[model samples]
Each structure stands twice: as structure tokens, then as C-alpha cells.
Target: MTPPSAPPPPADGLLAAGRRNLRALAHAVSHPSHPPTPLFADAPKRWQRLLPYVVVVALVATFLPLTITVLTDYGMSGGLAGAIAAVQTVPLLMIAHRPLQAWWIILPADVVGGLFALGGPASQSSWPWTPSVIVAYLFLMLALALRETRQTLIGVWLVTGAAGAVLGRLFPGESDGTNVLLLVLSAVVLVIGGALRERGEAQRRLVEQETISEAERAHRTLLEERTRIARELHDVVAHHMSVITVQADSAPYRVGGLPPEAQAEFASIAASARESLTEMRRLLSVLRSEDATGERAPQPGLDRLQQLVEATVRAGVPAGLSLTAGLAEPGRLPQTIDLSAYRIVQEALANVVRHAPGADTRVSVSSDGTDLTVLVVNGPPAGPASPVEAGGAGGHGLVGMRERVRLTGGTLDTGPLPDGGFRVAARLPLGTKEPVSP
Candidate 1:
């Protein structure tokens, strides 16, 4: 057997960790941070439109004061003082878009500016960290805290403290306590900024989740309405199949002297029809559960429209009805078309009642011998909306209406009016063929 490999030295482990940290620091210093919100986004519209000019003027105003302070108080040369002030203030403009890069520039400039101030007159005592430099750096730190990760923020704070410590040890000036003060203030700023950023992110995520949930609910409601329509249409097709089966089975008995071949054909037709009915019954069972016994009532037709409008009037909406001559006669239209028309009108009125409450509404049915038109229009709400309306138009009223019109091979148009109201119009063909079973 080969000898076992010895364990690596502890220093080697330390060295590897050090290299990894160096790489992380390099990455953190290079990449841009999150975009910051505009400083005056919530200002009045006219002011917001001129924000670019306002921001530029504000930055120049800030630069002028800092440059004057460094030149007059510290007794530094005018060119050097202006250069240092430019480096400190110019990066403030970039901090919103590129916090890390701005921090990299401003930190070194601050250290160099402070070092240069050390050569000034013995009377000036703001050495290692001037008041102007401290204020500027704190602003940058707050911006970084809002955009950068916690680890990056810690690294920035530590590096700042380390630079201050190195400068203090090398120079040993009277203003040595300024370094400690800046660090403490920056720590507080970082904490507050981080909390604000986290709150904004949480609110954004909540709004997005609500939007997705609403869309999913609407889709689910559409699927459920389709299932219900299929069950009703299944009943219509099943009725016709049963009638065919009965007629075919009685053909030979009702006629006299029928041939053997003819009798056999009639018997085969009845058998096939009965088999189809059996399959449909099985499908109907699957469509609704065993507990759906209350749904077995006969489907409504256009003849019930008058009763529906009357009931709606009794419920407090001022509604009217119009029916074309002979249009409400029984058997005037195919069973599928008649039922779909009634359902569409019913759903439209329900939406009006739920959404527009006390609005003036009209229900009209007319025919020009080929196609039938059903219209329901409502004016603006005359009273405050109900609590249910305040929550949302959460029901599948429009979805069910569209699905009914589609199955009957008709056209529907629905939209809001210019006067804060709504309209629903459906045109169903009077000669529509009976719908085939799915």
C-alpha cells in the first residue's frame, strides 16, 4: 500500500484564504451597484421635468463651497486645492449609478487631500480628516450602503478605518480623534441606509406577487367556466342522441312489410346510437362530482329574459327590456343558441348590478329574420359602489359570457363608453346549427 499523504501546513490554508479575499475585494471594487432612485422624483411635474439642470447646478454649488474652505482655511495652493475638491465632489454625481467606482476614486483623493493638509501652517489643526472631507465621504458611504451587499459594505468600512489608522500612526497629528469620529458616524449611516433599501425591495416583491396571483385567478376562473359550459352542452347533445335511438328502434315496427336487410340496418343504427349515449353518460359523470345533484334542473332559454329583467328591477336597479315581435316564441332558435343567448344576457346584467349598482340599464333583444342581437348597456354608477365592488370585479362574468358566445358561433362586443359607463352587445345567428358534442 502507498504511504498516506501528510496534512498541508496551516500557513498554506491561510495563504489560500488570503488570495480568495483579495479576489473578492477586487471584484467588489470593480462592479457597478444598483441604480439609485432619483433625488427629486416626487417633486411637482414641472420641477421634475427640469431635474437634470437642477442636479447640475446643485453639484456645482456644492463644489464651490468645499474648494473655498480648503484653500482659505488650510492655506493650500489654489490649483492643488481646486483639484482635490473636484475629485471629492465630482464623484458624488456618479455615486448613484456607480457607487463602487465612485468610492474608489473619492477615498484615495480624501487620503491624499488630508496628507497634503499636513504640510499646511501649524495653526490649522484639521489634519488626517478635515470636516469637509468627512461630510463628502459620509454621503458616498450612504449611497454605497443602499446599493452594495453587506459583505462589500463591511469591507469598505474596514478599509476606510485601516487607511485612517495608517495615516494617524505615520503622522501623529493633533486631530487624531477625527478618524474615530468619522468611522462611528459612517457605521450609523450604513445601518440606516441598509434598512431603507431592504424595505423598498420587499414592497416591490409584494406588488409583483399580487399581480401574478390575480392573473392566475382569472385563468383558473376561465377554465372552470369552460367546464360548466361543456356539462350543459353535453346535456343538449345527449337529448338528441336518445331521440335518434328511439326513432331508429321503432322504424321496422311502425312500417309494414319491411325487408330483412332494412330491419337489420335499423337495429344496427339503434345499437350504435345507444353505445354513444352510454359513453356520454360516463363523460357527464366525470364532468360533475356525485354531490352535484342540484345542477340537474332544466336549462333556461330566451323566454325567461322578461322574468330575469323583472327580478333585477326588484333588486333596485332602474332597468328596461325590449323584445322583437315573435322573437321570444318557443323553438324560434336552436336549443344551444337559445341557451347561450340567455346566459350571455344574464351574465351581462349581473356585471352591471355588481359593478354599476344603481346605474340606468337597458336590456334589448331584436331580430332581422337572420341574426338576433342582445344588448345590455349601463350608465355611470349613480350611488357609491358596494363593498364587493370595492374589493374587485372578482367574478368570471365576462369570461363566461365570451365562452357562451364562442360555443354558439356568435360575435360579442363589450367595452366602456365615453361617459363613464359600459356596453355589452352580442349577435347570434338565428339559423345556427345544433352544436356537436365534444
Candidate 2:
């Protein structure tokens, strides 16, 4: 027969890849060399966005007067003036699309454009270009600050200074030396501002990363604690409940020869208490740990099917077992699979004793190469009344059985049989066993 199929891998791989790509893109855009914070943090919401646009507009506005003067005095037409102005406008507008890492492109483009404008028809007066160039330098500084790039900030300063020097030569201004000095000073301010912005961005990124790490650590700790609790409850409560059930079943038989009324009453009380304790323990164990203990011996497997049958017989429930095929051949099966199978049988028998007492029960366990199958069927209760005691309708037994089968990638079905009893059938993959610590 074919080996059992493994469970499908988790579906989050694609989602994880997508998140990684997005993070890389954001880092390239906002941090470049440094780590990045959230996008909204790097691209501040309010006046920060408008500040870049404002600087660009102010620089262009300052240049308009110089262009107008040169055109008027040199007989330069409006078309030529508009064309020069449009060149600067187009590149600044493009900044909205490209990431700040591409700011180097804008620096050279702005400087060259400014020098060309100064040496052309707009050369009558240098006053307008001075403020315009300085304003452009300031805007470049702001962009560099936001981008946290030291080299770009320095480049912006050098380009602005060079443009001012060329303009002084072309226009022969009265205060040429002073104008150059002011432009040099402006560059210094831009560099300092850019440095500060970079520091802030770095700190923001560090804080965000720490927060994320802490939250993840806490979540993992909580999960581990829950798993430990589940394992503890399973060992403590399940063990005691098993012992109590054994004791309760033997109570009436041991007290034989007593008055019928006293015997029946004592049996009823014992049964009632056993059922109550089972329900209480089941509820309490809900919070138990999930971790399997390695020190504890692994649970019994299919080999213990006979022992499970005997336990049911001692509990006053007649159970017959049959195996048509797929025995593990000694050590072929893993411990986890064995334990799960044993538990499935144990639970099925327990249900038969509690819900179908005195009913004839048949258990069939077989393997079909890759899969192990178990079928438990019971006849109707032998007495006139239902075997299910009052207030014993907590459905945790079936739920627990299903949980066991699910962990092994198995299937289970249980319902009332058409013949007036109940039947539970399970199919577990033999190969897709989970890890058992022991």
C-alpha cells in the first residue's frame, strides 16, 4: 500500500514574500541605508508634504521678475521666458513620482537649468535668480533632510554655490561677493537641517523595531504557557477520571446481595458522581497545556487494543475487537501514531460504557497500506430506559475524539446507528504522524 500523505504546508509563504517585498521598497524609498519606520511616519501627514511644494513654487515665483526684466530690456519674447520657466517646473513636478533616493537627478538638473537661464535672455539683472537659486537650494536641503542623505545635501550646497558664482559673472552684480557669501551660508543651513532629519528618522526606526520585537516575544511566551497548561491538565485530570470511572463501575457488583432498593440507589449515586466528575474535569482541562512531555512514556498504540477491550469488559461493557489487516508488524509504526490510535479506541470504549451500557459493542481496526481505520458500533441499551444518565449530555467526549483525529490529519464520524444504537468511525493516516515528546 501507498505511504500516508503528509499534511499540506502552511499557506502563508506567499503572503510573507509579499510583505518582504513591500518592506524592501519602503526601505529604499524612506531609509535607503538605514532601517525604516512606517510609511506614514517617514512621509509626515501635514505641512511636511506641502513644504516641498511651497519651496518649489516660491523659487519659481522669485525668478519670474528677472525673466520679465531681461525680456523687456533685451527684446526677448514671452515664449522664450515661459520655456525657461517651464523647464524648472517640469523637473520639480516629477519629484512627486520618483522616490527621494533619486534626488541627485533633480540637483544637477536644477543647477544646470539655473546656470543656463542666467547666461541666456534673463541676464539683465542677477537679483531675481539669486533669490530663486537660493530658494531652490533651500528646497533641495529640505528634500535631503527628509531623505536623510548626507551626500545629497552636500551636493545641493555645491550646485547652488556654483550657480550663484556663474550668475555673478554673467550679470556683473554690484554685490557679487556678498551674494556668493549668502548663497554659501544658505548651503550650510541646508546641510545641518538634513543631518538633524537623518538622526530623527534613525531613532524613529529603532523605536518601531523594538516595539515590534517586544510584541512578538510576548505573543510567543503566551502560546508556550498555554501549551504547558494543556499538557498538565491532560495528565492530571484524565488520569484521575479514568481511575474514578473504574471504581464506579465496580461499585454495584461488589455490593451484591444488598436489598434491591439500596443497591440500585448506591449504583445510581456512584454513576451520577462519576458523570459529574467527568464533566467537571473535561471543562477544567480545557485550559491545559499543549506541549507533549518527553520524560513521560509515550501513550499506548494499536497493540494495546486488547487491553482497552479488557478495560471495557471490567467496566461491565461487553466489547469485541477484530483486526482484519494492517497490524504494525512490531516497530514499524511511530509512537505518536500508536498513542493516537490507542486513545481513539480507549475513548470509543468509554463512550460505549457510559452511553450504551450492557449493549453489545464491536470494534474493528484495520489498515489499508497508508491509512488506519477504526469502526466502533454498539447495539441499543439492554434495559428499558436509555443508558445515558441524566445531566450526562456534555458532548466533550466526541469533541476530544475529533481533536485527536484532526491532529493526525484524520477523519471521524459518529451518530446514532439505524439499528437503534450509536456508531463511531475514524480514519487516520498512518504516515502523517505528529511529534510526541516521549
Best by TM-score: 1
Name the top lDDT candidate.
1
Positional deviation of residue 184's Cα in model 1 after best superposition, in angstroms = 2.2
Can you give the lDDT of residue 416 in candidate 1?
99
Query: For model 1, what is the error of residue 56's alpha carbon versus the real structure, in angstroms, after optimal superposition?
Result: 6.1
> Could you estimate the TM-score for every candidate?
0.84, 0.38
1-438 per-residue lDDT for model 1 (tens digits): 999999877998999999999778766656654555454344578777466446545764786577557655787877778888888778777665567777888899888888778767777777688887887788788878877877678788888998899898888854658899999999999989888878877987998999999899988898889879888988888878888999999999899799999999999999999999899878878877678863667778889999999988887788999988777788787788888888988898888888888899999998888887989999998887788786885578889988887776678899999999999999887674553332
The Cα error of candidate 2 at residue 85, in Å, is 3.0
lDDT for residue 414 in candidate 1, whole number 0-100: 96
* TM-score of predicted structure 1: 0.84
Whole-structure CA lDDT of model 2: 0.61
Which 10 consecutive positions of candidate 2 have the poorest summed lDDT? Answer: 33-42
- Write down the lDDT that model 1 would get: 0.81
**1-438 per-residue lDDT for model 2 (tens digits):** 999999776779878887886665445434444333322333647676565556556655665565444433444457765565455444544333332544545445545444544433444444424444455445544555555456544444555566556656766743236456556666677667767776887898999999998788666655554454355445544555666666656766776676778767766766776787767656655544445223375345677788789888887788899975547455656544566677777777877777677889999988877887888998997754353453454334565666667666788899997878998898888775662331
